[model samples]
Target: MKKIFAILMTVSITYFASSQSKTFPIASTLTTIDGETINSNTFKHDGPIIIDFWATYCKPCIIKYNTLKDKYAEWQKRTGVKIISISIDPASRVESAKKFVEAFEWPYEMYFDLDSELISKLNNGSKVVPLTLIYDKDFNLVHKSTGASVLYEGSAKKGVKHLYSGKKEITDFTVDLSKYFEIIDQIISK
Candidate 1:
């Protein structure tokens, strides 16, 4: 799988570098799955935003989604943060975006950036999936990474906390978000 993925990325990068034209262009917002407008201003009033650029076929990407979906509420309550997932699977995969959401119902938001307009700017030109970006309230790019959050939780959290509060450490992965959301649902039902 690693070899296959590496080949694909290599192919993609090569193809883009050859034919993708000049520097990548970043569009503010196009349209989300739920038909909501998600742009730079959508987070104008919010704190640090975690933008996850992913696709429905990416398993590691889904793992990150499951994690954020589970801990999202607490992340909001504890830090007033927001997670925006942008799908970059091309225009043909838009339906998968909807199906993926229904299969795993997360309270967070997901946008269909099929062409990767906004996602391209995430890394300042790299069209990498699962690249999460942490930006300050003023929209200054703080940390931009291109990997799973679980593997990079320590660093991701450190930067997140630096922007969230005076704390030295942020939340860890052992928190079990899937079960966290489940418990919250159970309490709400009570």
Candidate 2:
């Protein structure tokens, strides 16, 4: 009886200990355009993260995101990968960010580095628009680059596909359609 009880206790303890997920240090606290503070520290680390840095006035940024926004959800489901769009636009442009989201009708979460400190720390003092930073489940840097799309390999979707599929054969990052989502409409329809 004593032996059985001891073994059961050990198994129970180990199961509980292993089940808790470890949180990552992506964003401590992010402010929303509606004046709300959301701590991104609780992101579900089930998979890697795709962080895109952008600004409202950036034409290229808009174009890149236009491509990104359409396929955000499909990517989330296909691989459990998620995107955290961080806006570099000024605080004054906070409203613009929110308006832009509304106009485009996107469902992904949006944010801005109002203090600009997050961008500096994450990218090592290099402030650039449309920067995509990929991190592993353990909070390790996978890929970092400044461009309209994550061109480390072929395109942004390729980066996402590579991360989820675990096809290490490809040394470059690209975004493939089957592993991503896409937007179909831009003009306000009748």
Candidate 3:
């Protein structure tokens, strides 16, 4: 009987921990394109937030950013959503990353994670580029994708295409922002 009781207690505790939502590591230190230091927690938006982790040399990451940029304005105006593009480039490539951002004229909030501290915290130390985390207004991490994902319409069914471990070519792939907006809407409505 004692063993059974102990097992039950352990199960209960594990369930409780697993069921809890995780918040962003706002305390993590990150740098801006201008080399200014700031705590990540300072980023707050009126609604849901999207954080994309990318590097200057990551092709898939670049494709995702460009695709998202096409519909970013509409997404923001409709949902008040904020997208933060965080470059995980090393210190040596910081200048290049800045140049890339400038050359593209990306309007989203941009930051630099030189040491990947924020990425490690959010992705359990996985060094995968093009990872995206979606958070609700309360900063609870609601959805995370490790690779490129896009919604597609085929055969009368909508589908999601996912590529992982940087193995897929994203030259022709485009993420469906509508699906992301649907997810945001669900989270915000809850």
Candidate 4:
């Protein structure tokens, strides 16, 4: 009985300890829009960090980026939160993505995962863009959200494939960015 209890306690402790420390692909290599290369582990900020995964072809991602750009200054001023934009655009679209970023003049640090290597590791082999990840000061992931879509019931059924086509208007889909902002607000308040 004593040995069984001891073993059970050890297993429980191990599980909790392992679960608390969420591991990311911190060593993954990424390239800046300027063509400079860096590792994911090099990201450093004074407070919380928001790692936003997006792509040039993702309309929902474009909307999210636009909204974030407008409020980025205020968010930084208030909470010291740093927004890191990770473009999950394929190698073929790298030039377009860089051009778009330069033309828009987004206020956040921009990086590219051309091979989807970083994003795949981060999202369990799912390379879906427009994904938002917020980490606390300690770099432990606290929140994650998949951005706007047309897949919701009663909404258009075009899905992400349509967004990639660039033929349909994105206004048909509902863009709700409130949840991400709310989560960021909560993390900063903490």
User: What RMSD does each model have against the real structure?
Assistant: 19.5, 11.9, 10.6, 9.0
Alpha carbon deviation, residue 49, candidate 1 (Å): 1.2
Separate clash counts for every candidate? 0, 15, 0, 0
TM-scores of the models, in the given order? 0.60, 0.68, 0.73, 0.73
Between candidates 1 and 3, the one scoring higher on lDDT is: 3
Off by over 4 Å in 2: 1-11, 149-190
Q: What's the TM for model 3?
A: 0.73
Each model's C-alpha lDDT?
0.60, 0.63, 0.78, 0.77
A best-first ranking of the candidates according to their lDDT comes to 3, 4, 2, 1
Q: What is the lDDT of candidate 1?
A: 0.60
Cα lDDT tens digits, model 3, 1-190, are: 9999999999999999766644554678899888999888778765789998999887567766877777889878887888998999999999999887887678889999989999998888887988889989768888988765543322222223333344445544555555677888897677
Q: Please list the residue runs of candidate 3 whose C-alpha ends up more than 4 Å from where it truly belongs after superposition.
A: 1-25, 150-173
lDDT comparison, 1 vs 2, better candidate: 2
> Which ten-residue region of model 3 has the weakest summed lDDT?
151-160
Candidate 4 stretches with Cα past 4 Å from truth are: 1-25, 149-174
TM-score of 1: 0.60
